[model samples]
Each structure stands twice: as structure tokens, then as C-alpha cells.
Target: MQQLESLIRAAENEVSRQMQVCNACRYCETFCAVFPAMTRRLEFGAADAHYLANLCHNCGACLHACQYAPPHEFAVNVPQAMARVRRETYEAFAWPQPLGALYRRNGVTLALATAGGLALFLLLAIAMKGSLFHEPLAGNFYAIFPHSMLVWMFGAAFGWAVLALAIGAVRFWRGQSPGAVGSAAAVEATKNALALTYLDGGHGDGCNEEDDRFTLARRRFHHLTFYGFMLCFASTCVATLYHYALGLQAPYALTSLPVILGTVGGIGLLIGPAGLLWLNLRRDPMHGDAAQRPMDRAFIVLLFATSLTGLALLAWRDTGAMAALLAVHLGTVMALFLTLPYGKFAHAVYRSAALLKWSIERRQPNRLRIGGD
Candidate 1:
């Protein structure tokens, strides 16, 4: 515990130190939200560090632009510093204090979660019907695993993940304690987050990626990934409404709303994760803490798996293989949900919170700019 706390402190301190140099230089002030946000604080406290770190987006523009990065006495690498701090902040703010350490071993956690989920579902499928292979059921998945049972099981996992994320966000919000958000601030923050404004690299173009070059590849992929995930979620919600409200059961038509949403979303997930993984693999090692790459890739791989299994199930929903595919797909979904709170998924949550803070903070008076002593 002491060791973990020390690591967190060191990360925060490094960001604090880097921010001071950055504040003085202000060369990258327009680079992203992080710089302008940094100007709002003459000193980066724990709260300030946490806020700035998450807000950074690890875009790498500042690092590439920094004259002081590496080989310099100050050795300012803002993205890397911010990334180290962001990872620490996620662990620190993670709910279930004991589970916080999972962040350190996220890759292993993901693998275990995946393997465990697959085993559980596969075994459950066999136990349910006494055979891995089932008679043709025509895509009615409820035949394999009862709807109520899945609801209860997945609901618990999803609920826990949501609760953990909510708690963690609350803790982070309290840490920064950014004053009450006005309607304008909230709207602005939402817009920024939805559009990923910071990834713009201060120009309208895009942030730096593999080398000194700029690319919108990351931003585009991110959009596809999240939007795709949301579409899949929307499909689920619509399907649920159809089930209970409209008396419409599983095996909705190919042209139906639910299937369309899932299919489109699933495609987005496939393209987005594949692109993101490619970018991650090719990204400059110095762009962020290279150590966190495994965790990032793990999350990406999980997203890809989730989409792949889902699409496969959708494609073969009418065959005897539907049961088997459904089990694997559910297993993948379970893994994704189980790891949501403790893995790279937390990045989106924390970063959103930080963006909201920025939106609110930007509206308030800036003492540094006001006095100018």
C-alpha cells in the first residue's frame, strides 16, 4: 500500500512540476484544453493535478511541440506526465478500494475476466441443455438461457460496473470540487466531450500520432468505437422495450429497428476497435506512458471481441450454432461489462468529468489574468 501510494504521489508530483514549466512557457497554451486549463492554476495541487491529468487527452501535441521535452534540464513531457498521473488518478479514485490495484494489472485482469466469462457461459450452456450442440432453435436465444436468468446475471454485473463508475466519478468531482456548473458550462462540456474537441491539436486538423505528423485517425476511430457501443446499447434498450412493452420477443426481423441498430453499431465497433488497435500499435512510445499500452490494448481487444462475437451470433442466429455463438457473445459482453470500471473504460468517465470541470472553470474569472502582477 505504501508503495502504491508512493507511486501515485510521484506521478502527481511530476505533473505538478511539468505544469509549472508549462505555465511559464505557455507555448502550447492553444494546443489543447490542458494548457489553458493549466493557466487557471498557478500551482497544481493534488486535485488540480488530477483534473489536468485527465483533461490532457494524451494527444501528444504538447510533447512534440515542447522545446524542453527530453534531453533538456527541465525534461518536460506533458503528455507522458499527464498520462502517468491520469492512470494513478483512476486507481486512486476507483471504488472498492481493494480493487483499485487491478488498474496496475489491467491486462491480466482483462484476460482472466475473458477466460472466466467464456468458461462460465460455455459450461452454463452445456448444463442448461446437456449438450454443446443444440437442435435448430431459429435464433430464439431465450431457448438456451432463459431471458430472466440473463437479466438477473448481466444486470448484477452491469449494475455493479455503473455503481462503481458513479462512485469514482463522485470522488473525482469532490477532489477537484469545481464550483457549481451552470447550464452554459454543462452544455459546453457536453459538446467538447462529444466532439472530443481537444484531440484537434489546437488546429482544426488533428493531434500528433506516431511521429511528428498530425492525424485525425485516433479521433475518428474513437468516435466510431463509442458511437458504435452506444448504438449497440440502444439496440438492447429498444429490444427490451419490444420484449416487455410491445410483446415483441427475440428474433426481430432483419429489417427491424433493433437488428438494424445492433448491426450498424456492431460494424462501427469492428471498424473502430480495429483502427484504434492499429493506432495503438503504431503510436509513438513516448506519446504517453508506454507502460499503460498493455492496458489500452487489452480494452481495445475486448471491444473488438465483443463486436466480433456479437456479429457472429447475429449472422448465425437461426442455426443450431446459435446457442453456442450466443454463449460466446454473452461471455464477451460479460467480460466487457465486468472490467468496465477498473480498466481503460474508466478513462472515458474520468476524462468526461475533467472536461466538465474545464467547462465550468473556464467560465469563472481568472485571477492570474486579472492581476498580472
Candidate 2:
């Protein structure tokens, strides 16, 4: 308990110091929601820092625009400071606190978990078919594992991820002391979250990472990734509806809605995650917390692997390798869903909640009265 408190104090102190400096400068206030939110407070405490940390998008635009950055006496780096506290928040508010340790060495844990899942699925396949090499099974994934069995396995994992993420988001929201949110604010927040308005650097341009140069690559990639995941999810939902409602079975045609959506979404996932992984590697170390690299990379790699394997399975569905590819793809997907809560994916959930709070708070009159309209 004492150790946790100390960690919280350290994060809060760093965030507070940076917020103080940024508030005084107020040059980058137009860059993102974090600055405008920070201006609402004359002083910051643990809760305020926590709220601001999650509210930050860590786009690195503020750092590039800040005159007091680094070599300056203030040593202000908003993205880095907020990132540190954001990591702490993830650990502190994680559904199962003990499992939160996975954030550290997350890459190793993710790889091991994925390997274990793949091996388990492959073993099941071998047991079911009684052979490692089976004849081309066409598009009948149920040949290896029954649809009921697949539903039970993946349904449980997906349900758990949703529950854990919900609990964590609720916990964080309660901690922020958000008052009643107006309907307009709620709609605006939803729009901001879906569009990732803040990541656009508060303008149509883009964010800064390695240097002062602005680039829209990150925002575009994120759009692809987010929409791709959604499309894939929609495909799954449609497939379920077809199975239960329309009596459609496995191996929908290429022209089918489900297949088309999955194909497009898979492509987007490939490009988005690949681009994100590349940017993550090339990103400036000083922009965000360095220690969070493993967590970030773990999620990115899993997403990319999931999409890549799924696409491969689609392309080779009629080949003898189809069964093995299907197992590998299912395993990667299971890993992705299982680790969704504990991985860097939780950032989106928490950030969306923070945006809701910010939008509501912004509706309220600014108490600081620092920036005149």
C-alpha cells in the first residue's frame, strides 16, 4: 500500500510540475484538449493529475511547440510526463491489480501467451483430425473445431475483456469526479473520441513526434486501425446473425457482405498496425515514457499478427495448410482479445472516458479565468 502511494505521489508530482510550467506558458493551449483542461485548475492534486494524464493524447505536438522544452530550466515535456502517469493509472486501476504487472515485460508475456494459445489450438486440431496434415477442407473452419466450441471459447474471452475494460473505465471515471454530463457534451465527446479530434494537433495538419515537423501519418494510421477493428467486429456480428437468423453456414462467398467486410478490415488492420509499429520504433524517445515500449509493441505486434494470419488463411483456405493457418489465426485473435484489457489497448477506453469528462467540464465555466475569449 505504501509503495503504491509512493508511486502515485511521484507521478502526480511530475505531472503537477509540468502542468504548472505549461499553464504558465500557455503557448500550446490550442494544441489539444489537455492544455485547455489543465487551464481549468489553478493547482493540481493527485486526482487532477490523473485526470489530465488520461486526458492527454501524447501526440508530442506540445513538446515541439513548447519553448521551455528540454534544455530549458523548466524541462517541460507534457507528453512524457503524462505518459508516465498514464502508465501508473493503468496499473493502479486495472481490474485485477496483480495482473497489472503484465504491463512490465509485456512483450515477452504477450509472445509467450500467443505461443501457448497457438500450441493449444494446434494440439486440438491434431486431436480432432487425428493427423497433422489434413486434406484441403475448403472454407469449412468447423471441420477442425465445431462452431459451438469456437463460440464458447472466444465468447468467454471477449466477454471477459469487455467486463475488465468496463470496470477499469468506470473506476477511472469515478476517480475523476466528473459531474453530470450534458447531452450535447456527451455527443461532442463521442464525436471527438470516434474521430480522434485531438490527435489532429487541434488543426487539420498533424502531430509532431521525432521533431518539429508535422505529419498526418499517425492520425491516418489510427483511423485505419480503429475502423478496421470495427469492421472486423461488424463482420463477426453479421456472421453470427447469418448463422442464427439466416441459416447461413461457414465459407461465405467472396461476394458476401461478411467476406468483403472482413477482407477490407483485414487489409486496414495490416496497414494500420504495421504503420504504427514503424512509427513506434522511429518515435523520439523523449516524447513519451520509454518503459512503455514493450506494452505498446506487444499490442501492435498482436494486432498485426492477427490480421496477417487471418488474411493468409483467407488466401489459402483451399490449400492443405488451411487448417494450420486457421489454428494460428484463431490463436492470435484469442491472444489479442485476452490481452485487450491489460495491454496498451486500454488507452483508447480510458482516453474516451476522459474526453467525455473534458467535454462536460469545458461546458462549465472556466474557473481559472486565465484565457480570455
lDDT (tens digit, per residue) of candidate 1 on 1-373: 7988899889989999998887778888788888788777787778888888889987888888889999889999988888899888888988998899888787945655775667576768566767777778888888778899989988899999999999999998987779998999899999998999999898977978889899999999999999999999999999999999999998899999999999999999999999999998888888888778878988999899889989999888888788778877888888888888989999889999999998888888887782211
lDDT, candidates in the order shown: 0.87, 0.85
lDDT of 2 by residue, 1-373 (tens): 5787798899889999888887787888788888888888889998888888888887888888878888998889889989999988888888887877776657846665875677576768666758756789887888877899999999999999999889988898888888998999999999998888888787768877677788889988998999999889999999999999999997999999999999999999999999998898899999888889989988888888888988998999988877777888888888888788888988988888888998899888887677822
Deviation of model 1 at 12, angstroms:
0.7
- Specify the highest-lDDT model's number: 1
Query: What clash count does candidate 1 reach?
Result: 0
Q: What's the C-alpha lDDT at position 235 in model 2? A: 90
TM-score, predicted candidate 2 vs. hidden true structure: 0.96
RMSD of each: 1.8, 1.7
Q: TM-scores of all models?
A: 0.96, 0.96
